[model samples]
Target: MNLRRLKYFVKIVDIGSLTQAAEVLHIAQPALSQQVATLEGELDQQLLIRTKRGVTPTEAGKILYAHARAILRQCEQAQLAVVNAGQALNGQVSIGLAPGTAASSLTMPLLQTVREQLPEVLVYLHENSGSSLNDKVMHGQLDMAVLYDRAPTAGITSTMLLKEELYLIGAGDSPGHNVDLADVAQMNLFLPRDYSAVRKRVDEAFSLRRLSARIIGEIESISTLTAAVASGMGVTVLPESAARVLVSSTNAWMSRITSPTLNLPLSLNVSSRLPLSPSAQAVKNILLSLLSKPTIEDRELMLVG
Candidate 1:
């Protein structure tokens, strides 16, 4: 049961000689033999066969050797992980998430994960527009951001997290059926401001179809837009994650946009000009891991790919 005795037993079996193993381990031969004897006594197994040509393991000893190696390797890995985390995980990490996108849903999960995995790190979250979040990342105000990709920014690097298809959301008691792009263009639409990535994509899609989108309102606040759509104010275009949330929480329905489907690129943006701090990098790793392993609730909501 003793880790030290198990280690000694492993060394003796590996070298095929107690004397040589003791010498290599910086322990006396008699003491090393006593450790092995104690281990065998505890396990009630004849572990070693001592012969004139040094020693070899019994069947029992071979099994113990395999298990001991695994246990020791796991212990070493635990120690190293703790040491590395302690060295660089203490600090504040600032992260941004654009509202109305799937990234916004990750705010609570990221917080919970960072709290559980890296207790020493402090997290500061900001909810803003995609363009605004990207600007903050570029200026080093934010360690990283989850937002839609914009035109190539000079000092920003983006890693695509997911590509979400845009849907037309409207107020309805039942789920709406899929609608064509031309049908979407005919509806009164409430959308984000012109500067937003979503707005730009919607505009381009409409232009390509030679159809004009009737923009009755420009609503930037997600809550306001959701309320407007749910109140029968007008229909709006949004990606799957946001549309799902709005439809589930309110009297709304989401229909997929067909006939030249519009897709939005959700990405993790960081400053290309500056390296991330250790604490920030640790937080980033946690974020990526959480995204890669989506929860059942997230899958049900169709929040992330």
Candidate 2:
């Protein structure tokens, strides 16, 4: 397909008026109409429905519009890659980090790395729930995200970054140890809301054993949750990375949940349909490199592709 004709078609569909598209393209309306006609002829499909008010894409046109957008975006990225070749990448790349996992802790390191390596690239970090971040990534609102693998991956590509074993965090500072799932289930728990990916996993694991977790409250904030755990109000489940931080700072302890190992896989996700810009790809590479390295605090984390 002719890139120019596809561009004209997209603009017309966006504005819903060939006249306006011509005005924006600085071309005659007849020429713009001819371009669309030629595009429709080439594709052998009726792409639009024109009426007195405006034009709307036909079923085929809707499909074509989506593909055209992806194609155009890839073309733009290619142009940028060529232009910025052998030069430092400089652009804004937004990434989402789902809370309640080790992924959330990478915000500072990500910023520091970008500042040191890709100084010209500006990073925008979004810390949110996995489902929220997943939606943002699928919609192309974010360049990439680190989310739990439990989230739906229908419209995005997710590569497992690491697997973190869940730990039961509770009061008492006797070094960390193993805690059976049956025993841990009896404790009053404070976990994220049911909609959260971690919460769903916790619930599913309990359901499989025909036992229910005694959850006292839903806590999303780490500080509040840790405070509650430290005050002996209740226990909460967290990955080793987050549990380590809680135990180090608070009068609390973390025990690896066993008797049915529950591990949450953290994955790096990006849109499957849209291509990443050069700057975004560079930041993604940095994230992969940083997260892949082994650390003392997260020694048990199982790194994946």
Candidate 3:
């Protein structure tokens, strides 16, 4: 296999434009495209789909890119192993954090930890919902993710970070008390959409026990959901930290559900398609070390450390 052609193909995929890739490679545009075509012909598979905007990897291409990235990374590491024997490591890592998990618990602390420890690594941080983050990981767009999904999507692997008790958040002015799941099922509630990750878990929990909640409204936005709860529009379920993000210092109160206690689990997920770069592995190590402390909502994280 020609390592040079593999590098060129990877570069084009990275930049998403043959023209841009040619410019970066300092080669003629036609020559760049031809080299890519030759690579495709040799492999006997269509790797990239060209569009008006740019090029995207096909499923086969995504798989090839994943393996190619790992191979190329191993090559660089092999070189670094000899050249920079005792030097500080340097590389780039792209990571995604699910929104609910990022609330004062993981995002900033994780960033600070990386900056303080692995100063040479360039970290690209992306914050989105679990569904989106999982999608990005599968497509080889993100190196790893810290998210809240007990059961991750296909082509991804995960380890548990923490198991948190789910709570019924309500206005502080209202009666603040521990409500059993039976009672919780009777309250006026504003829940996330039916397809929501949390909602799916919540529904499964309820279904397992053959219990149901009086869901009054379906809220898509956390801010709106918190506001409605604070206004006494309805109650919503969330982990303590996430509920606090919506109304930490405000009049909202957090109380755990009982009689079939509900729990929300957070996880660290990585794609099976790609190998972890050294930079990403370093970040993962740091996170595993740090999760033992009170970084989460004063809860004990089920960590490797």
How high is the CA lDDT of each candidate model? 0.83, 0.85, 0.77
In model 1, the Cα lDDT at residue 261 comes to: 85
lDDT, candidate 1, equals 0.83
Tens-digit per-residue lDDT, 1-305, candidate 1: 97788778878977899889999999999998888888989999999999999999899987787677656644644555576774746667889988887877778898898888889889999988877887667645678999888567766888888889999999854335778988887688999999888899999999998999999999998889988998886899899989988888987888888888889988898878556766788899988887778657767769654
Tens-digit lDDT track of model 3 for 51-115: 99999999988878867766676676567667757778667788887656633365677788888
Model 2: what TM-score? Answer: 0.73
Evaluated with lDDT, which candidate comes out highest? 2
- lDDT winner between candidates 1 and 3: 1
**Which residue ranges in model 2 land beyond 4 Å of their true spot?**
1-79, 82-86, 173-176, 298-305
> Model 1, 160: alpha-carbon shift in Å?
0.6
TM for every model, in the order presented, reads 0.68, 0.73, 0.75
Model 1: weakest 10-residue lDDT segment is 72-81
lDDT string, candidate 2, 167-226, tens digits: 898886443488888987888899999878778889989999888899999999988887
Off by over 4 Å in 1: 1-88, 173-176, 297-305
